[model samples]
Target: MKRIFVLLAGLCCISCLYPQAPATEAILEAFENRSRQHLLHENEAYALTSFSPAYLFDTLLPAAEARYKKHPDTWLQVHLLRLRANAASNHRNLNNNIGIRPESVTLTEEAIRLCHLEGNDLLLAETYFDMAELFNLYARHEEYITMLTKAFEIADREGHDYFPGILLYHKLAGMCKAAFHINSYRESIHYGNRALAMLGALKRPPDLHTEIFVYDLVGFSYKMLHQADSSIFYYRRINELLKGRDTSTVFYKLWSAIANGNIGENLSAQGNAIAADPLLEQWERAGIGFGDSANISLARKAQAANYFRKGEYDKALQCWLFVFEWSKKEKHFTNAAAAAEGIASVYRRKGHVDDAFFYFRQSQVYNDSLTAFNNRSGLQAVQAKVKLENLQQSLANSKALLKVEKRSKQFLLAGIVLLAVIATLLYNRQRLKAQNRLQRLAQQKREAELDARKTKEEIENFVRHIKEKNDLIDSLRDKLSSDTALKARQDILEGLSEYTLITDHEWEQFKTGFAKTYPSFFPAMAARLNQVTPAEERLATLIFLGFNNLQIANTLGIGRESVTRARYRLKQRLSLSKTEELEELIAKW
Candidate 1:
């Protein structure tokens, strides 16, 4: 850092009275030597402060200027450009620290070219990381994300980086924080927690001030979750830690004051306004930058609780009802839940149990959602970091792949353009060749599509034709079954005809056709009819069917007792014992 030397030079002129200490001179010499050898290794990326680059340019420009004044040299001028580039890049990084973008982008690009010209991967990665921040500031999220992701890959491969606690890793995480501001709070929580966890897994915590700010952010995130109890506890712990570490830290006052006020509200809900009042007043102070109305909802909640505990239900309900209105404006889950729950409690005491039950359930559901939101938010951070890292790696691979593909496409495109130009030139002399090639390509494409279409059409046509054949068969069958002319003949045969009212003429043929279609029907009918027979002779006569008595008996498969029993069952079924005869029963049916 030539800046360090310039300041030393200024101090040296005034050191007669102050006395430049030997240790300070030794430090100056070391810095001057180190600045001379800048960008020689990757270690400088971590060890070099922002001031180092400016100091390096400050020391080198004069030397390079003095060298050129004597005689011009190519190497000297290039080296000066290189130093200037590094110095400009570091300047960009400082601008990045202060939230500037376009200037940072310009400086980062220059830095990368300088590094590339000098074959420096480590400095290039740093430059690229800075470029990512510029894009992130502009809300060019996809491109910005792509850039750091590339740097992360370079850092992993050729750039010589260790994970987590490094400045680059935090830079990657900081880029991810842009999402959080865009109401991508879920992603914000994810990336923030991932950054925290990565550092945690790094075997040692970073003592860096930037990293300490990350812890502050994490603690504040819990409060936003409306987990007041958990929020208060963590904030109390962080507040104590921050005070012990940096007593003058402004955020310590700002965030911790808010956290303390939140805890007081929680206590107030359990019915303690006296305790909460002081914390609310502290947050309401001008130095904290918090307005009185900002915490009025909390004060109202405390007042409602005090009234409720005093057994003044109407006054309590009125306070809680106002709290309910205030909570909506506040839109804070803890304050809202407390407000709703307080209203429910007042209703329960007033003996409106049903209303109390409804509000009570609403309160519980909101409270549980808040808890799950907080826990899941933290876990999501871990997952997002993995995803971010993975996405970064994927983007780098994609870039490299894109480069190869782009180059190949460019080559192919160039060839295509050249071929078209050649074809254009040849058209005057050999038009047929070009025409044939174009036609062949067109025809091939058409044939492929035609084959696909034809195959699909053939399958559809075959299915349609089969369906038509089945329809024709169904139509013919319907015509035969519904024909009325065939049913008009006496003792009509209905096999190939229609339903008929038949007579005794041609009854044998009718019976043959009827038995063919209804073979089992007759057997069941005969058994039922035999039970109704009035005499043993008729039961035997039904089985006889023009056979001898022995053959008939065998066909009936009955001893004389069953025949006699059948006759008795028949007489009972016919409601006739002595009045019924076999011949009369058969003739009647």
Candidate 2:
């Protein structure tokens, strides 16, 4: 409630301080032309590339601000506010720009409120989504969630608006990916699956490559969780999707490769080095030297295993040596230790007893370190559980105490009220008794004094009512809703109907508006991002943002089998190929 008050107070201040400028019909018409074109095609792949759209949207920032000053009118202010907020929303994707400050959170929130005030539901959803992203970047998960929920509410209210639904679904899936990395895999799938389902229901060639992203994340999470069959399923789905698409996308190709690499790893782990190479080779070829430190290590390990299986001690040792040196440089302790153990094994095979012992001891050291890390994590988990239990008990006790206090206050108030009534009756009784001994004037005087006392008591009772309300809020750690007319507003739905969510036609217009504005730009942007990251990039992005492989896969509308393979690839591109982690690689990327 306090949070609500603060949010409301801030909004109230903004509304009061920033008066809307009176805009002219001419300027209003001009803006409508520009906005209609921009919003209509905003999601098109080439919208940003087209000069007219770009000029009207991105490059026209200065023009909008200039127009605001030039006209200082109602239509212009509305246009400026909407465009400015939207421009910030758009600029969020360009953090690669290094020095640009995206629109402030306060500005975004205010703009969203303004849109609501103006009944621009689509605009409100769009602005809120941006705010959610801002919260995510700042590591404020709860805030991100609140904003996301609000965005969904507005978008859903828009009804059948493709853009709002799609964008909201996209963000939810992305949030799921982030959740997976944080070890909140279930939630990851929850969001991912919803997003995938939404995508599956849409037309092909895609409105946005969101389905691909969710699938990649799902697949990667599955791989990390070691669900080999499920991982393969998602990877295979990706493969099918990539038949006509460029297999050269750093991310997409990497997953196909990782699918192969992991299959090889699984084989090699079971002592079938000969069978693993073909898969590993495919992964390597797909790599294209894209700064994949982890893949290089994994490839080397696989090669070492193959040589070891073939009884080529020297070759096996060489591969292991490379893995050892590189894993150490990359700080991949587990892989480094594995390489050390393999090196030691190779030395033993070569009859180098002392050298074998040295590598064996090194392996032991890493093993001990890993044991310690696991122990520490386990200890923390146990402590956290205990602390949570204790907190829950404490909260229960606090609630009990609050109830007792409330009852005590009620008793005291009841006693005081009874005394006031009794005293009034006694005083009136005394006045009647005096009627036989006093004049009419004196009785009238007593009546006047009694009326004054009654008025004072009423004023005191009102003050007490206010105080009690304040106390109740204080006890709840919330705001005192102290509105005397609150009895008339007992239903929350009565006032904030705008916050209610319902899916329908307005949502379709939103999608159409953005698509018309961008014109294939969604796919184009996907293509551009893919050039560096690929379709498989979603795995890393999803995981980095958080999501478990299963959830990720579900969101992508594929089996977890495919997600596993994608993770293998994501690990390589993100330079975490050798790690069993679902998080570090994402952070590195």
Candidate 3:
């Protein structure tokens, strides 16, 4: 009898471990049924990407809620709430709502509370991540960061293989990429690398979609940092990974075209415009084939930049004009502003000062419009108040006129004169306000132009000084080589070589000046700084300053072969491909 009791107790314990298995299975079955009834590609793994809110609200959420009500289980409740929150959030996003829905936040918070109450770390971490996603959708970045940090801490402590580890890192990478701040790109690359490492470490065949997205994010961050070789390397990796996949599918074609365009852009930036042409053309063709207007616009902009860099001013102007018109028509102020700026630059290069100034002002107008739109709430409130005051004043004027009319003719005439005076005063006030606003804008534009010219002059002066120093060193080396007693004066030669080499103090001054012009340069190089030797760092800096191999060798007091070897070693340390030019990479920096 005791043996039977022990066996029963063991069975009960085992059952307790999988208490919600049936409930989970039921929920999944309902989900599958609903997806089959509504989704066109129900059996596909990515069917949810095309999910409609109606399906979520009318079918999936309803079914999940019913199951939760029937089962009265905390796990089921949490699952249902998560689905509900996702549905609400998706609905808001699809409708292009200004902010996240309160219901979505509430549902996610309740799910989190339930998870905490149940002591389920995994569930709590997932819910926190869900909350983070909701915050991200609304661009509440601080809250998003907080939620993600909490989720990561919990997931790290729990040691979950995939739930929070891979997913959280991927989301963190994406978040950092979209942050649009200095150091954000490096942070993005850092997280993206981590995510990629985690994906590779997985025992199972990793999700290709997640892996590709992380690669794309990292590649884009590199591109923004002007690490062209690194950018192209990762983009090419995407293309390689997509091999043998269905070429006709939107997913395959979209990513493939994006990769091609990005690689071409990087190549063009590296001054390989001829090599980039075919790739850019392929990307543009794909955009046209897919009828994607945004992609077409982006491709045109990239082509314009390439042409502009290659001194094809006419071609650049044509492309910029097209983008400008299209963007204006679409009311995309940001693109319109960019196109206008490009147009102005092209005109300036062509020596069309008036046209350049006109376009510059046009760009400014578009920028101002964007600024106003971003602050539309306050502007709207101010406008509303002005309208209300005008209405109230008009009402008062009407009452006064009525009272004057009831009095004698003299009073009526006086009232009419007083009203005319008031009207004149108001007209003068509005005209003065308009003039003042225009004057302020004009002054701001002039100041901006002056500041830009000053910065350009300063950078030119700095570069010229470095070139002059290098020229002097080169001259000294030429004289030394021709010296008859050069072998006997070995100490003098060494001193000259030491003078040519940049000392620590000189390097500090160079960096300070460079940082003034390109503030993000060092920050972008921060990740690789620790790994590179001091000589390699100097080589990179010289390369970035537009120094050639001969000039770099002379500057460092080394032979050309030594410089080449150092460059090759640096390239390897940086993990660049053989075909990727180290010069192109460092010069971009």
**Of the candidates shown, which would achieve the greatest lDDT relative to the real structure?**
3
- Highest TM-score against the true fold, candidate: 3
Candidate 2 structure lDDT: 0.56
lDDT of 2 by residue, 105-175 (tens): 44654565455444566555555665555545444444555566666676567663435234445577756
| lDDT, each prediction | 0.51, 0.56, 0.68
Q: If scored against the real structure, what TM-score would every candidate get? A: 0.35, 0.42, 0.48
Q: How close to the true structure is residue 530 of candidate 2, measured as C-alpha lDDT?
A: 46
User: Where is the poorest 10-residue window by lDDT in model 2?
Assistant: 1-10
Error of 3 at 291 (Å): 2.5
RMSD of each: 32.5, 39.3, 44.6
Q: Which stretches in model 2 have alpha-carbon errors above 4 Å? A: 1-58, 66-103, 115-122, 133-150, 153-192, 207-214, 244-256, 266-275, 288-294, 298-589
The better-scoring model by lDDT among 1 and 3 is 3
Which pairs of residues collide in model 1?
1-55, 1-56, 2-55, 2-56, 3-55, 190-381
Off by over 4 Å in 1: 1-123, 133-146, 156-166, 169-173, 198-212, 222-237, 243-255, 262-281, 286-589
Better of 1 and 2 by lDDT: 2
